[model samples]
Target: MSWKQQPAVVSAPPSEDAVRIRTRSGIAAVLFLPALFIAKVLLLATDKGGRCFVDDIACAPFPDTAFGALLVAVVLALVAAMAAPVRVARGALRAQLLLEAAGVLVVLAYP
Candidate 1:
Protein backbone atom coordinates (compact mmCIF):
# COMPACT_ATOMS: atom_id res chain seq x y z
CA MET A 1 0.00 0.00 0.00
CA SER A 2 1.05 3.55 -0.61
CA TRP A 3 2.40 5.27 2.51
CA LYS A 4 -0.17 8.07 2.08
CA GLN A 5 -3.14 5.82 1.29
CA GLN A 6 -4.71 3.15 3.49
CA PRO A 7 -4.78 -0.24 1.81
CA ALA A 8 -7.95 -2.17 1.03
CA VAL A 9 -6.48 -5.10 2.92
CA VAL A 10 -5.63 -4.59 6.54
CA SER A 11 -1.88 -4.17 6.97
CA ALA A 12 0.58 -2.33 9.11
CA PRO A 13 0.74 1.36 8.28
CA PRO A 14 4.14 2.55 7.10
CA SER A 15 5.04 4.68 10.07
CA GLU A 16 8.64 5.56 10.88
CA ASP A 17 8.87 3.22 13.83
CA ALA A 18 7.20 0.40 11.94
CA VAL A 19 9.49 0.97 8.97
CA ARG A 20 12.61 0.97 11.12
CA ILE A 21 11.59 -2.15 13.00
CA ARG A 22 10.75 -3.95 9.77
CA THR A 23 14.06 -2.94 8.24
CA ARG A 24 15.97 -4.24 11.24
CA SER A 25 14.06 -7.49 11.08
CA GLY A 26 14.72 -7.83 7.37
CA ILE A 27 18.43 -7.23 7.85
CA ALA A 28 18.62 -9.65 10.73
CA ALA A 29 16.96 -12.43 8.77
CA VAL A 30 19.23 -11.73 5.83
CA LEU A 31 22.40 -11.93 7.92
CA PHE A 32 21.37 -14.44 10.57
CA LEU A 33 20.34 -17.39 8.40
CA PRO A 34 23.43 -17.42 6.22
CA ALA A 35 25.72 -16.88 9.18
CA LEU A 36 24.18 -19.80 11.01
CA PHE A 37 24.22 -21.89 7.87
CA ILE A 38 27.90 -21.17 7.45
CA ALA A 39 28.46 -22.02 11.10
CA LYS A 40 26.84 -25.41 10.52
CA VAL A 41 28.93 -25.97 7.42
CA LEU A 42 32.05 -25.18 9.38
CA LEU A 43 30.90 -27.55 12.05
CA LEU A 44 29.97 -30.37 9.68
CA ALA A 45 32.42 -30.17 6.80
CA THR A 46 35.34 -32.58 7.15
CA ASP A 47 38.23 -33.91 5.05
CA LYS A 48 38.44 -37.59 4.03
CA GLY A 49 41.93 -38.37 5.28
CA GLY A 50 40.53 -36.90 8.34
CA ARG A 51 39.63 -40.54 7.74
CA CYS A 52 42.62 -41.29 9.98
CA PHE A 53 43.45 -39.20 13.02
CA VAL A 54 46.55 -37.08 12.89
CA ASP A 55 48.72 -37.10 16.06
CA ASP A 56 46.16 -35.19 18.17
CA ILE A 57 43.22 -34.92 15.77
CA ALA A 58 40.42 -37.44 16.05
CA CYS A 59 38.85 -38.05 12.67
CA ALA A 60 35.82 -40.28 12.52
CA PRO A 61 33.45 -41.17 9.70
CA PHE A 62 30.80 -38.76 8.39
CA PRO A 63 27.80 -39.65 10.54
CA ASP A 64 29.78 -39.61 13.76
CA THR A 65 31.35 -36.28 12.92
CA ALA A 66 28.05 -34.76 11.89
CA PHE A 67 26.28 -35.98 15.00
CA GLY A 68 29.01 -34.57 17.21
CA ALA A 69 28.83 -31.25 15.39
CA LEU A 70 25.05 -31.14 15.80
CA LEU A 71 25.37 -31.77 19.50
CA VAL A 72 27.92 -29.00 19.86
CA ALA A 73 25.81 -26.55 17.87
CA VAL A 74 22.68 -27.33 19.91
CA VAL A 75 24.48 -26.73 23.17
CA LEU A 76 26.00 -23.52 21.90
CA ALA A 77 22.67 -22.27 20.57
CA LEU A 78 20.89 -22.97 23.83
CA VAL A 79 23.55 -21.16 25.79
CA ALA A 80 23.46 -18.17 23.42
CA ALA A 81 19.66 -18.05 23.38
CA MET A 82 19.77 -17.57 27.12
CA ALA A 83 21.56 -14.22 26.75
CA ALA A 84 20.03 -12.89 23.51
CA PRO A 85 17.16 -10.46 23.02
CA VAL A 86 13.92 -12.45 23.19
CA ARG A 87 12.93 -12.00 19.55
CA VAL A 88 16.46 -12.52 18.25
CA ALA A 89 16.97 -15.55 20.45
CA ARG A 90 13.77 -17.15 19.27
CA GLY A 91 14.73 -16.64 15.64
CA ALA A 92 18.31 -17.87 16.19
CA LEU A 93 17.23 -20.96 18.06
CA ARG A 94 14.53 -21.75 15.54
CA ALA A 95 17.06 -21.54 12.73
CA GLN A 96 19.48 -23.69 14.71
CA LEU A 97 16.76 -26.27 15.25
CA LEU A 98 16.13 -26.44 11.51
CA LEU A 99 19.82 -26.74 10.69
CA GLU A 100 20.13 -29.51 13.21
CA ALA A 101 17.26 -31.34 11.60
CA ALA A 102 18.93 -31.09 8.21
CA GLY A 103 22.19 -32.20 9.75
CA VAL A 104 20.44 -35.25 11.15
CA LEU A 105 19.17 -36.09 7.70
CA VAL A 106 22.63 -35.72 6.24
CA VAL A 107 24.08 -37.92 8.95
CA LEU A 108 21.43 -40.54 8.33
CA ALA A 109 22.08 -40.44 4.59
CA TYR A 110 25.85 -40.70 4.97
CA PRO A 111 25.91 -44.47 4.85
Candidate 2:
Protein backbone atom coordinates (compact mmCIF):
# COMPACT_ATOMS: atom_id res chain seq x y z
CA MET A 1 0.00 0.00 0.00
CA SER A 2 1.15 3.53 -0.79
CA TRP A 3 0.70 6.45 1.62
CA LYS A 4 -0.35 9.88 0.32
CA GLN A 5 -0.45 13.23 2.11
CA GLN A 6 -3.82 14.95 2.33
CA PRO A 7 -4.50 18.63 2.01
CA ALA A 8 -5.12 20.72 5.11
CA VAL A 9 -8.69 21.25 6.18
CA VAL A 10 -10.27 24.60 6.95
CA SER A 11 -12.49 24.87 9.98
CA ALA A 12 -15.25 27.36 10.64
CA PRO A 13 -14.63 30.42 12.77
CA PRO A 14 -15.21 30.27 16.51
CA SER A 15 -18.76 30.68 17.80
CA GLU A 16 -20.01 33.84 19.51
CA ASP A 17 -19.81 32.19 22.91
CA ALA A 18 -16.19 31.27 22.35
CA VAL A 19 -15.41 34.84 21.28
CA ARG A 20 -17.19 36.22 24.33
CA ILE A 21 -15.34 33.89 26.67
CA ARG A 22 -11.98 34.81 25.15
CA THR A 23 -12.80 38.52 25.33
CA ARG A 24 -13.83 38.26 28.96
CA SER A 25 -10.72 36.29 29.80
CA GLY A 26 -8.56 38.90 28.10
CA ILE A 27 -10.24 41.62 30.14
CA ALA A 28 -9.74 39.65 33.33
CA ALA A 29 -6.06 39.25 32.55
CA VAL A 30 -5.71 42.95 31.74
CA LEU A 31 -7.17 43.92 35.11
CA PHE A 32 -5.31 41.37 37.21
CA LEU A 33 -4.87 43.36 40.42
CA PRO A 34 -7.77 41.45 41.96
CA ALA A 35 -6.16 38.11 41.19
CA LEU A 36 -3.03 39.43 42.91
CA PHE A 37 -4.88 39.49 46.23
CA ILE A 38 -6.14 35.96 45.76
CA ALA A 39 -2.72 34.75 44.73
CA LYS A 40 -1.14 36.46 47.75
CA VAL A 41 -3.62 34.80 50.10
CA LEU A 42 -2.92 31.41 48.61
CA LEU A 43 0.81 31.98 48.80
CA LEU A 44 0.61 33.04 52.44
CA ALA A 45 -1.38 29.93 53.23
CA THR A 46 0.92 27.56 51.35
CA ASP A 47 4.34 29.14 51.94
CA LYS A 48 5.19 30.81 55.22
CA GLY A 49 7.88 32.87 53.52
CA GLY A 50 5.99 34.01 50.39
CA ARG A 51 9.13 35.55 49.01
CA CYS A 52 9.91 34.91 45.36
CA PHE A 53 13.61 35.43 45.79
CA VAL A 54 16.11 33.08 47.42
CA ASP A 55 16.47 35.25 50.52
CA ASP A 56 13.77 35.93 53.14
CA ILE A 57 13.87 39.66 52.49
CA ALA A 58 10.66 41.35 51.37
CA CYS A 59 10.36 42.68 47.82
CA ALA A 60 8.55 45.85 46.81
CA PRO A 61 7.33 44.37 43.53
CA PHE A 62 5.79 41.36 45.26
CA PRO A 63 2.50 41.73 43.45
CA ASP A 64 4.30 41.19 40.14
CA THR A 65 4.52 37.55 41.15
CA ALA A 66 0.83 37.16 40.47
CA PHE A 67 1.04 38.21 36.82
CA GLY A 68 1.60 34.77 35.34
CA ALA A 69 -0.70 33.15 37.89
CA LEU A 70 -3.53 35.54 37.07
CA LEU A 71 -3.00 35.03 33.34
CA VAL A 72 -3.26 31.28 33.74
CA ALA A 73 -6.32 31.67 35.95
CA VAL A 74 -8.03 33.89 33.40
CA VAL A 75 -7.32 31.39 30.64
CA LEU A 76 -8.66 28.57 32.80
CA ALA A 77 -11.79 30.54 33.60
CA LEU A 78 -12.44 31.02 29.89
CA VAL A 79 -11.94 27.33 29.24
CA ALA A 80 -14.37 26.44 32.01
CA ALA A 81 -16.89 28.93 30.76
CA MET A 82 -16.60 27.53 27.25
CA ALA A 83 -17.21 24.00 28.54
CA ALA A 84 -20.56 24.95 30.01
CA PRO A 85 -23.48 24.18 27.67
CA VAL A 86 -25.73 26.98 28.89
CA ARG A 87 -23.51 29.70 27.38
CA VAL A 88 -23.28 31.95 30.43
CA ALA A 89 -20.70 34.23 28.86
CA ARG A 90 -22.33 37.41 30.09
CA GLY A 91 -22.67 36.03 33.60
CA ALA A 92 -19.00 35.06 33.68
CA LEU A 93 -17.94 38.45 32.40
CA ARG A 94 -20.18 40.23 34.90
CA ALA A 95 -18.84 38.17 37.78
CA GLN A 96 -15.26 38.97 36.78
CA LEU A 97 -16.10 42.66 36.59
CA LEU A 98 -17.77 42.61 39.99
CA LEU A 99 -14.84 40.81 41.56
CA GLU A 100 -12.37 43.26 40.03
CA ALA A 101 -14.44 46.20 41.27
CA ALA A 102 -14.70 44.76 44.77
CA GLY A 103 -11.00 44.08 44.82
CA VAL A 104 -10.27 47.64 43.76
CA LEU A 105 -12.58 48.99 46.45
CA VAL A 106 -10.98 46.87 49.13
CA VAL A 107 -7.48 47.85 48.08
CA LEU A 108 -8.41 51.51 47.99
CA ALA A 109 -10.17 51.38 51.34
CA TYR A 110 -7.34 49.59 53.07
CA PRO A 111 -4.43 51.32 51.41
Candidate 3:
Protein backbone atom coordinates (compact mmCIF):
# COMPACT_ATOMS: atom_id res chain seq x y z
CA MET A 1 0.00 0.00 0.00
CA SER A 2 1.15 3.52 -0.85
CA TRP A 3 2.01 5.83 2.05
CA LYS A 4 -0.94 8.04 1.09
CA GLN A 5 -3.35 5.07 0.97
CA GLN A 6 -2.25 2.91 3.87
CA PRO A 7 -4.46 -0.17 4.39
CA ALA A 8 -7.21 0.38 6.92
CA VAL A 9 -6.82 -1.49 10.16
CA VAL A 10 -10.23 -3.12 10.17
CA SER A 11 -11.11 -5.12 13.27
CA ALA A 12 -13.21 -8.27 13.28
CA PRO A 13 -16.45 -8.49 15.29
CA PRO A 14 -16.47 -10.34 18.57
CA SER A 15 -16.02 -14.12 18.28
CA GLU A 16 -18.65 -16.59 19.44
CA ASP A 17 -16.76 -17.20 22.66
CA ALA A 18 -16.61 -13.51 23.40
CA VAL A 19 -20.29 -13.11 22.66
CA ARG A 20 -21.16 -16.04 24.91
CA ILE A 21 -19.07 -14.63 27.76
CA ARG A 22 -20.75 -11.25 27.40
CA THR A 23 -24.22 -12.81 27.37
CA ARG A 24 -23.41 -14.85 30.45
CA SER A 25 -22.19 -11.78 32.29
CA GLY A 26 -25.31 -9.84 31.33
CA ILE A 27 -27.58 -12.60 32.59
CA ALA A 28 -25.62 -12.93 35.81
CA ALA A 29 -25.83 -9.22 36.51
CA VAL A 30 -29.55 -9.22 35.77
CA LEU A 31 -30.15 -12.22 38.01
CA PHE A 32 -28.36 -10.54 40.90
CA LEU A 33 -31.32 -8.23 41.46
CA PRO A 34 -33.66 -11.06 42.43
CA ALA A 35 -30.98 -12.79 44.44
CA LEU A 36 -30.35 -9.64 46.39
CA PHE A 37 -34.04 -9.22 47.08
CA ILE A 38 -34.32 -12.75 48.37
CA ALA A 39 -31.26 -12.38 50.55
CA LYS A 40 -32.56 -9.17 52.13
CA VAL A 41 -35.90 -10.78 52.85
CA LEU A 42 -34.32 -13.80 54.45
CA LEU A 43 -31.97 -11.70 56.52
CA LEU A 44 -34.79 -9.57 57.78
CA ALA A 45 -36.86 -12.58 58.71
CA THR A 46 -34.11 -14.31 60.64
CA ASP A 47 -32.78 -11.21 62.38
CA LYS A 48 -34.58 -9.73 65.36
CA GLY A 49 -36.79 -6.77 64.74
CA GLY A 50 -35.13 -3.62 66.02
CA ARG A 51 -34.29 -0.10 65.06
CA CYS A 52 -31.53 0.74 67.56
CA PHE A 53 -30.14 -0.31 70.93
CA VAL A 54 -28.84 1.53 73.98
CA ASP A 55 -28.23 1.00 77.72
CA ASP A 56 -31.93 0.20 78.14
CA ILE A 57 -33.53 1.25 74.90
CA ALA A 58 -35.97 -0.89 72.96
CA CYS A 59 -36.96 -0.85 69.29
CA ALA A 60 -40.43 -0.74 67.83
CA PRO A 61 -42.03 -4.13 67.30
CA PHE A 62 -43.38 -5.40 63.99
CA PRO A 63 -45.88 -8.14 63.26
CA ASP A 64 -44.68 -11.59 62.25
CA THR A 65 -47.51 -12.12 59.79
CA ALA A 66 -46.62 -8.95 57.88
CA PHE A 67 -42.99 -9.97 57.75
CA GLY A 68 -43.95 -13.44 56.55
CA ALA A 69 -46.08 -12.00 53.78
CA LEU A 70 -43.21 -9.78 52.66
CA LEU A 71 -40.93 -12.79 52.52
CA VAL A 72 -43.44 -14.73 50.44
CA ALA A 73 -43.74 -11.88 47.93
CA VAL A 74 -39.99 -11.62 47.62
CA VAL A 75 -39.68 -15.34 46.99
CA LEU A 76 -42.40 -15.25 44.34
CA ALA A 77 -40.74 -12.36 42.55
CA LEU A 78 -37.40 -14.18 42.62
CA VAL A 79 -38.93 -17.30 41.05
CA ALA A 80 -40.55 -15.26 38.29
CA ALA A 81 -37.36 -13.41 37.63
CA MET A 82 -35.34 -16.62 37.32
CA ALA A 83 -37.84 -18.17 34.92
CA ALA A 84 -38.05 -15.13 32.63
CA PRO A 85 -35.94 -14.82 29.49
CA VAL A 86 -33.40 -12.04 29.17
CA ARG A 87 -35.84 -9.64 27.48
CA VAL A 88 -38.62 -10.30 30.00
CA ALA A 89 -36.18 -10.47 32.87
CA ARG A 90 -35.31 -6.83 32.45
CA GLY A 91 -38.88 -5.80 33.12
CA ALA A 92 -39.12 -8.03 36.17
CA LEU A 93 -35.82 -6.71 37.47
CA ARG A 94 -36.92 -3.12 37.01
CA ALA A 95 -40.19 -3.83 38.79
CA GLN A 96 -38.49 -5.45 41.76
CA LEU A 97 -36.01 -2.62 42.05
CA LEU A 98 -38.72 -0.02 41.83
CA LEU A 99 -40.84 -1.71 44.48
CA GLU A 100 -37.90 -2.05 46.86
CA ALA A 101 -36.79 1.52 46.33
CA ALA A 102 -40.29 2.85 46.79
CA GLY A 103 -40.75 0.89 49.99
CA VAL A 104 -37.52 2.26 51.39
CA LEU A 105 -38.40 5.79 50.39
CA VAL A 106 -41.82 5.59 51.97
CA VAL A 107 -40.45 4.20 55.21
CA LEU A 108 -37.75 6.82 55.47
CA ALA A 109 -40.00 9.67 54.44
CA TYR A 110 -42.94 8.65 56.58
CA PRO A 111 -41.22 7.19 59.61
Candidate 4:
Protein backbone atom coordinates (compact mmCIF):
# COMPACT_ATOMS: atom_id res chain seq x y z
CA MET A 1 0.00 0.00 0.00
CA SER A 2 1.07 3.59 -0.52
CA TRP A 3 2.07 5.75 2.47
CA LYS A 4 -1.35 7.43 2.51
CA GLN A 5 -3.10 4.09 2.01
CA GLN A 6 -1.43 2.60 5.08
CA PRO A 7 -3.38 2.64 8.29
CA ALA A 8 -2.86 5.85 10.20
CA VAL A 9 -1.79 5.52 13.79
CA VAL A 10 -2.74 8.19 16.30
CA SER A 11 -1.44 8.07 19.82
CA ALA A 12 -3.47 9.64 22.59
CA PRO A 13 -1.86 12.15 24.91
CA PRO A 14 -1.23 11.31 28.54
CA SER A 15 -4.29 11.58 30.81
CA GLU A 16 -4.58 13.61 34.01
CA ASP A 17 -4.55 10.46 36.12
CA ALA A 18 -1.40 9.32 34.44
CA VAL A 19 0.24 12.66 35.04
CA ARG A 20 -0.62 12.69 38.75
CA ILE A 21 0.57 9.14 39.22
CA ARG A 22 3.85 9.93 37.51
CA THR A 23 4.44 13.03 39.59
CA ARG A 24 3.84 11.14 42.80
CA SER A 25 6.04 8.25 41.73
CA GLY A 26 8.82 10.58 40.66
CA ILE A 27 8.67 12.38 43.99
CA ALA A 28 8.87 9.09 45.81
CA ALA A 29 11.83 7.93 43.74
CA VAL A 30 13.65 11.21 44.28
CA LEU A 31 13.06 11.00 48.02
CA PHE A 32 14.17 7.37 48.23
CA LEU A 33 17.78 8.05 47.14
CA PRO A 34 18.48 10.82 49.59
CA ALA A 35 16.80 8.95 52.40
CA LEU A 36 18.89 5.88 51.73
CA PHE A 37 22.04 7.96 51.56
CA ILE A 38 21.24 9.75 54.79
CA ALA A 39 20.47 6.52 56.60
CA LYS A 40 23.62 4.84 55.35
CA VAL A 41 25.75 7.81 56.24
CA LEU A 42 24.29 7.94 59.72
CA LEU A 43 24.79 4.26 60.26
CA LEU A 44 28.37 4.44 59.10
CA ALA A 45 29.13 7.58 61.04
CA THR A 46 27.88 6.05 64.27
CA ASP A 47 29.92 2.94 63.83
CA LYS A 48 33.10 3.12 65.94
CA GLY A 49 36.55 2.66 64.31
CA GLY A 50 34.85 2.47 60.89
CA ARG A 51 33.33 -0.87 61.81
CA CYS A 52 29.63 -1.28 61.06
CA PHE A 53 27.00 -3.69 62.33
CA VAL A 54 27.99 -7.16 63.47
CA ASP A 55 29.77 -8.70 60.49
CA ASP A 56 28.52 -5.59 58.69
CA ILE A 57 25.18 -7.20 58.03
CA ALA A 58 23.11 -4.10 58.59
CA CYS A 59 25.53 -1.60 57.13
CA ALA A 60 28.61 -2.94 55.45
CA PRO A 61 31.51 -0.68 54.62
CA PHE A 62 31.68 0.18 50.94
CA PRO A 63 34.66 0.98 48.75
CA ASP A 64 34.98 4.39 47.09
CA THR A 65 34.20 3.02 43.65
CA ALA A 66 31.10 1.25 44.88
CA PHE A 67 29.94 4.36 46.67
CA GLY A 68 30.52 6.45 43.57
CA ALA A 69 28.58 3.98 41.48
CA LEU A 70 25.72 4.10 43.93
CA LEU A 71 25.67 7.87 43.81
CA VAL A 72 25.56 7.86 40.03
CA ALA A 73 22.82 5.26 40.02
CA VAL A 74 20.74 7.30 42.43
CA VAL A 75 21.12 10.46 40.37
CA LEU A 76 20.18 8.67 37.17
CA ALA A 77 17.22 7.02 38.82
CA LEU A 78 15.98 10.30 40.19
CA VAL A 79 16.25 11.90 36.77
CA ALA A 80 14.42 9.04 35.14
CA ALA A 81 11.71 9.12 37.74
CA MET A 82 11.18 12.82 37.21
CA ALA A 83 11.21 12.69 33.43
CA ALA A 84 7.55 11.87 32.82
CA PRO A 85 4.09 11.28 34.27
CA VAL A 86 2.67 8.33 36.24
CA ARG A 87 3.13 5.41 33.87
CA VAL A 88 6.64 6.40 32.92
CA ALA A 89 7.42 7.37 36.47
CA ARG A 90 6.24 3.98 37.69
CA GLY A 91 8.67 2.21 35.40
CA ALA A 92 11.48 4.48 36.49
CA LEU A 93 10.56 3.94 40.12
CA ARG A 94 10.62 0.17 39.66
CA ALA A 95 14.04 0.33 38.08
CA GLN A 96 15.33 2.60 40.80
CA LEU A 97 13.95 0.31 43.50
CA LEU A 98 15.51 -2.74 41.94
CA LEU A 99 18.89 -1.10 41.61
CA GLU A 100 18.88 0.18 45.17
CA ALA A 101 17.67 -3.15 46.50
CA ALA A 102 20.38 -4.99 44.62
CA GLY A 103 23.01 -2.66 45.98
CA VAL A 104 21.76 -3.16 49.49
CA LEU A 105 21.69 -6.91 49.04
CA VAL A 106 25.23 -6.89 47.74
CA VAL A 107 26.38 -4.87 50.72
CA LEU A 108 24.61 -7.20 53.11
CA ALA A 109 26.11 -10.22 51.44
CA TYR A 110 29.60 -9.03 52.30
CA PRO A 111 31.13 -10.33 55.52
The C-alpha TM-scores of every prediction are 0.37, 0.42, 0.36, 0.46
Question: Per-residue lDDT for 26-57 in model 2, tens only?
Answer: 76757676555765465545444344334556
After TM-score superposition, what is the CA distance of residue 96 in candidate 4 from its true location, in Å? 1.6
**Leading candidate by lDDT:** 4
- Please write out the lDDT profile of model 1 over residues 25-104, one tens digit for every residue: 44543564466466545444555332333333454446667667776776566554444555666665665566556654
What is the lDDT of every predicted structure here?
Answer: 0.54, 0.55, 0.49, 0.63
lDDT of 3 by residue, 1-111 (tens): 657877999988655544544454456556655665655455444423222322223545434565456546645554555555556555555555555554443333321
Deviation in Å, model 2, residue 102 alpha carbon: 0.3
Find the number of clashing residue pairs for candidate 2: 0
Query: Which residue segments of model 2 deviate by more than 4 Å?
Result: 1-13, 34-79, 82-86
Query: Which candidate, 3 or 4, would have the higher TM-score against the true structure?
Result: 4
Predicted structure 2: lDDT: 0.55
Clashing residue pairs in candidate 4, if any? 21-86, 22-85, 22-86
Quick one: best TM-score, which candidate?
A: 4
